[model samples]
Target: MLLLINVLLASWFYTAHGQGKPCDYPVIKHGWLYYSYRGYFPAHVNQQFVYSCDRYFVPPSQRSWDHLTCTAQGWSPEEPCLRQCIFNYLENGHNPHREEKYLQGETVRVRCYEGYSLQNDQNTMTCTESGWSPPPRCTLVKTCSKSEIRIENGFLSESAFTYPLNKQTEYKCKPGYVTADGKTSGLITCLQDGWSAQPVCIKSCDRPVFEKARVKSDDTWFRLNDRLDYECLDGYETREGRTTDSIVCGQDGWSNKAACYERECSIPQMDTYLNAYPRKDTFKVGDVLKFSCSQGRIMVGADSVQCYHFGWSPKLPTCKVGKVKACAPPPQLLNGKGKEIHKEEYAHNEVVEYVCNPRFLMKGSHKIQCVDGRWTALPVCIEEERTCGNIPDLDHGDIKPSVPPYHHGDSVEFSCREAFTMIGPRFITCISGEWTQPPQCIATDELKKCKGSTLFPPVGKPAHMIEYDHNTNKSYRCRGKSEHKHSICINGEWDPKVDCKEEAQIQTCPPPPQIPNAQDMTTTVKYQDGGKNINSM
Candidate 1:
């Protein structure tokens, strides 16, 4: 019987193996050996083998398996069996029934549809023997939040609205109105299907109204809308408001035509002066008048007077009686030609005499008297003529006599003695019988004029390089770039060399080329740096 059983077993093993089928078997050899349809097994069934067999097994009676048997079953293992199955499938290019399998602590990725983003985790959980836990789910993400809208002095249809992600709000201003900040087309932010903040609508001003200068002249007056128009009375002009028919009325008051009146003053007249005559028909506030005395008469007070609000400026000045008087008497006298006496006062016709010591001579008159309450003449004392006649002449000198003998009223002049130049006065006068000090002369060589050199060259278009005289002005121009240049002397100082090619040449150019509107050209270049660097280009 054992022999017959061995033959049958052997035949069955060969047949099953040839069919590429999998099966399970009972333990063998008194628990020391075991066998399956295709292979030998141990007493204890290996869980891994059992899983594999279960995945590919068919009912034992339904035999007739072929090389494609495993694929035809469409059976795939779970967990441990699937891991090996997957390996087999990869190695042999076989298709497995199990779509996917995750081990413990493993994750599977998940994705959302178009137009949507995952709000929850986008990955899956692993399957344990306890069964697959719920996989991570994906949710759409929202980009915008609800927002509020506000209008100045008004209300909004809705204060808030939920906006989809990446969306915006369009704004419009009310009729008869404009935007204060943003225009009618304004926008608000939408974050995660919500708005960041409320959008605002602001109020604006209307057409401006002009106020006459009398009403808005003061700076304090201004329109509520931050705009104002200004106008002035007839005969006045506007100084500011131009466009927009409005002005900002600065601290200096209304800018446009401001009211004002013409200023005027009444004419003035003159007052009289003491002891003076008027030279004109009338006088004004500042007129000046003069005063004087008749010939043989003298003035005693101010000679001029002015007209003022309070009549003449310094009160009318006066002119009084006049006379010529002699100086007070000297200390001493000699020869006693006449007795000396002191008088309280002298009348019109009073006479007095004077004399000098023996060797000295005097100048001026010897006797004087009063006439018309004034001194008739000046009196002086002197020595006799005999003393002056005896004076001797020095070497290199000569004694020249007067054409008319020297008398009390006569004067004489003297010149240098030959080569010797006299060093004192050259004229002398006779007074009271004696001649005054002799005259002196000076050398002629000391009277010549000074000689100096001219600073500028006399030829070659004499460019007054510079002149010491402050009043002299000069301009220079070169013929060409090689030598000619344009230059000017400012306040007696010459400018550094300038290129002539860029400037007008002297005589060769017709009066500086008749610069058309030169002044306007100056204005154009005034703020410009000038084309000095043109050559670099």
Candidate 2:
């Protein structure tokens, strides 16, 4: 029983030891973890246990652990102790093995040095159970140094300059010269040594010239900057100044000279109608004279003639015959006013008659006889008298009697007062103490009113068709449309609206008959009483 107990205790101790937890490995700065394990363990253990140094154990198969029985009993055969121990270790930070040191297979990064860019990969190898792969390398950056410096006016040679480090040069222009643009003091910049390029200089012109001409000297011949004197020619005059004159050749042209000669007039002439007769005396070349015509006859040519240098004058005048007889062509008769027994030639005791146009009255004798080759006295015709007794009251206008009694052959005019028109003649003749046609008083208001068929005829529109009130001088548009109805009525005669349709269908009526040629006539035909009696064969 004692031996069995002891064996049991030993087995238990082995099992417990095999079940021991993995030991934690300390991670060195810039380091990694690595691991290893056994291939087999005791059969009673079935499987080998495995663990990472920093984390918990993984499955045995993953860690290279397996199941295998111990060959000799009593004490387990230490066949390399069934499983070897595993751990982590530190390495050169740049070594590839350092990647395995990390249990999580984490990565580690490297960077370039200051003032340098990375030429290789930006990041180094990652960290694993082994250690960091390899640290990245850093390189040095390139730089330029200062060269030469240059300068230019109103311009720059190159945009920028490179220098070794810190250095400069002073800028300038030559003596007696100035900069065209930019700073006169010059410019400066830092180069390793001095400036890059150089500066330049420029030049300018001189003052202007003055000149003048003398009266004796030809102005066209004078040169620039020349001084001269002046004098007038014979018979010519100069303004004030002896040497007071001066001129210059300006942007415009030459200047300065003397005034030239001018002629004046002496004795002049008197203007008249007859041929000009100049005074018979010695006179200067430009002198002028004039003349006139004698009485009884009028001058036929230019009213006044003048004397010229060549001879007598520009024009000649002559008298023309004057009229002798007092009477001229026989005067036109007024009303029944004047008569001439005969025209051009008149004989004694020839009788003549004077008659006025219809409606006018004669105020003197209607007949005159010639005496001593001339008609007797002239006669006059006047307006005839119109008596209101015979006058009719027209609808559109009115007439009032004159204050003075009308004479036998006198007449008076009638008219519409306002807003009215006289439909008939305003004047009426007096016949046996009564008016031939009476003057009428009428209304203007009713004249504008129309009350007929609204349909206008296929003829031209009417000028007027108004009804007139005789009592009030009022007029209104007229009523009804008739073929004979006048569009307007004036002087008691109707002016009817004309139908244009007839005009469209017909050519104008043939012109009035012309006298038949005697050669063409067979016999004469007499036309009378609207019928013709044919006498021709």
Tens-digit lDDT string for candidate 1 (187-286):
6666753565565544443333343344343443242344454444332233332222344433333344333322111222322223345555556544
Give all candidates' CA lDDT scores: 0.38, 0.38
At residue 395, give the lDDT of candidate 1: 41
Worst 10 residues of 1 by lDDT: 519-528
Cα-based lDDT at residue 278, candidate 2: 61
Query: In lDDT terms, how accurate is model 1?
Result: 0.38
Model 1 bad stretches (over 4 Å): 1-117, 120-162, 165-187, 191-198, 205-224, 227-457, 460-537
